[model samples]
Target chain A: MKNRLRLLAYPYILWMALFVVAPIVIVVIYAFGSAGGGFTFDNFSRMGTYLPVFIRSFKLAFEATVFCILLGYPLAYILSKESSRSQGILVLLVLLPMWMNFLLRTYAWMSLLENTGLINKLLTLIGLSPVKMINTPGAIILGMVYNYLPFMVLPIYSVISKLDYSLIEAAQDLGASSAGVFRRVIFPLSLPGVLSGITMVFVPSVSTFVISQLLGGGKYMLLGDLIELEFLGSAYNPYLGSAVALVMMIVVIIMLLIMNRFGEGEEQAVMI
Target chain B: MRDKKSRVPGRIFLALIYIFLYAPIIVLLIFSFNSTNSRTVWSGFSLRWYEKLFNDDMVINALYTTISVSILAAIIATVFGTFAAIGIFNLRRRWQSPVLTLNNIPLMNADIVTGVSLCLLFVASGTILGFGLGFITLLLAHISFNVPYVILSVMPKLKQLDNNLVDAAQDLGCTWLQAFFKVVVPEIKPGIVNGALIAFTMSIDDFIISYFTAGSGTQTLSMVIFSMTRKRVTPEINAVSSLMFVFVLILLIIINIRSSVQDKKLRAKPA
Candidate 1:
């Protein structure tokens, strides 16, 4: 009976083997293969030429992650303090924008950030010089933070809300101030959520092509843009794209592993 | 007094963040009503863009493709995922862990890598299958990413099940298939439903994966928006988005109500 029940999974297993696992295996083979159709280290060896793109991608992703934590932690903490009904509605609102088409959300900013855009129009109205807001590194990072902020907020908010209120009361009863109670009790207990939140924000921000493409104005080339160019754009180098993608896969995996180590087996609140 | 003061700042902070988040969407929504074709200019209040959006064949085709793909992918993923979740649940601890790790690959990896990998797979297979990237590949890739969410959703419900329930069903003269279908499946229906909703949402919102796998022949709604963004965008996109925003809002509200009602039913079930 049990075997028959397990037999039900055979179709799914077959599907994942074809669609998920086999694709990665293909990426590996392509990553190492030469254009002439033999094994070669040329792809890895030429990676140094694109080091600046790698650095910029990581640097921007890092700054975005930091900003998400700074902005989102407070937001999550405050959100958790709300009544349960309000918390549900607020959480939904926080997540609703992300459900909208990603490209539309990014394009909305494009109009606002253009040189003759609304932001500039408002600036000129105040007798201030127009700032070049669009197509800058700052704009790209802003895009990342705005899109991924909910990821940071949701996990930490879940963790903090689940923390034992008795611990906070216990600390206060022992003469710990409110700040001390939060710092020692609430914050430490919520580290797992924070760590996972960091991973969530950092991974997507690092790998986004459209955000950089639309906001960075073809001036700033991140690894995502580089990889996309190698694959779909004029460059048309699948081997090089595979190599970059492999490295990206490795970096994301390593970061997630580090996060999981600190997250202490709290289930990833991925459903939202 | 300190508590009240802190509360005031907390409300302010929430207000500011809400403003930050909604500003772009508000801007987009307002411009959809602008009379002129220019994205920045507002000649007068009009629905010209919205009218244009519905008439454009490209927009209509892409919208059709987007909806069909999302629905098909979500339904298929939910079916496969629910079965797999049960199978994994019943597996030995050692085997289950490894399967779960493989499952997380899609969830954890960057969208670009997943899309590229799948693109490579399809291109390579095209040599034998005689099919390159298009609607088929796009649907397949979406199903791939979406299945993991379904699996993750169903796993928790499986964990919640009483271990001996199936056995009890069998002892009550039910056959193995009957026990499985009539007893086990109904228990995890909520999880299955939740997974489908998540899968649908993810499929609808996905851009990066769809961008890579969609190839040149076909375009999803986001792909159309992307092409527009690359050049000077028309106000027609704004109209499409406003309609989409309302459509999705209504869709989500309906789904939420259905699920909450189901949840209430589950609670009312006698222990």
Candidate 2:
């Protein structure tokens, strides 16, 4: 009976092998195989042209991750302290915007950050000159931060809310300062959530083609845009695109591994 | 009074975060009703754009396709994934861990990579299958990405199942399959439902993967909006977006309320 039950998983296993595992092999095949249909490192060799793009994508993603940490950590911390009823409501509010179609959320910013957007209109009405907010790296970073902040907050909040209140009480009774209690006990305990949050925010921010295009106005070419350009956009080169994607996959895996090694106790915090 | 006074900063900080999160959505909502053709300049509010969205064949077709694909993908993935989770749960630890790791690929990989890789797979398979990328491939891609989430959601519930429950049903003279249906299905129904819900939510909101696998022959709502966005301004998209926002908002609210009520009942139960 047990064997028969385990046999039920075989069909799904076959499905995943075809859909999930095979495609990754194909990505590698295309990445390494040259246009002439022979194995070559030419695709990777050609990545020099996109060196600036790689740098800018990582730089911007890093900046956005930092911003999310600064903005989200406090929000999650405070949210952890709220009454459970209000906590549910507030957490929903944080997540509701994310459930809006990804494009719609970015498109929301397109209207807000444009030269004649609502923000600019507000500025002008107040007798201030309109600022050029759209089609810049800053706009792209802002878009990344805006879209992924909830990814950061939700993990941290889940971790912190479940923290042992008795630990804090013990620290306070032992004469630790409130700041020291938070710094030593709370922050250290919440590191898993923080680490997972960094992974969640950074990966998407780095790999986002839409946020850069819609917000950066095609002026800046990040790794995502570069990959898109090869596959679906103006440039029709999947080999080079595969190379870029492979590089990104490796980088992301390495980052996640390092972080996982540090504190992934609540790594499942991300599924929330 | 002093304690409340000291709490003002955290409250203000949270308020500002909320504003940052909502300001863009509010802008999109406000523009959806703009009377003038322009998205930037707001005249008196009008329902013209919403009316236009209703009349627009492109938007309507995309919406139809989007809903169809999401529903199909969610249901199919949930069925396959629930069985897969049960199977994995019963497997030896050695094989189970490897399969679980494989399951994380779709969730962990960047959407673009997943999209591009799947696009390649469909194109390659189409050569032998005599079909190219289209609605079928699009639906297939949605199901593929959604299955991992379903498996993840259901596995926990399967683990929570009582060890003696299945045996108890079998000893009562039910066939193994009958025992599973009679005993196990009811136990894991919540998980199956949760998996389906997550699958649906992920599918409906998906763009990047769908954008690639969908091909030129088909379009999801995300693809349509993306095309509209290429232009400087398209007020119809704003109207459609506002509607989507409200629809999801309502759906989420209902789910949230139901879950909270369930939580209350669970808590109220005597231990």
lDDT of 2 by residue, A215-247 (tens): 999999999999999999888999999999999
Residues B1-271 of candidate 2: C-alpha lDDT, one tens digit per residue: 1267767899999999999999888878888889988778878989998898899898899999999999999999999999899898988888998898889989988899999999989988999889989999999999999999999988998889997988998898988888889889998988998999999999999999999999997999999999889964678888888899889888877887898898899899966
Identify the runs in model 2 with alpha carbons over 4 angstroms from their true place.
Answer: A263-272, B260-271
Question: Which 10-residue window in model 1 chain B sums to the lowest lDDT?
Answer: B1-10
Native contacts present in candidate 2, fraction: 0.83
Among residues 3 or more apart in sequence or in different chains, the pairs in candidate 2 whose N, CA or C atoms overlap within 3 Å are: none
Candidate 1 chain A has its poorest 10 consecutive residues by lDDT at: A263-272
Q: Candidate 1 on A160-223: residue-level lDDT in tens?
A: 9998889888989999998898877788788878987998999899999999988889899998
DockQ, model 1, C-alpha based: 0.74
DockQ of each: 0.74, 0.83
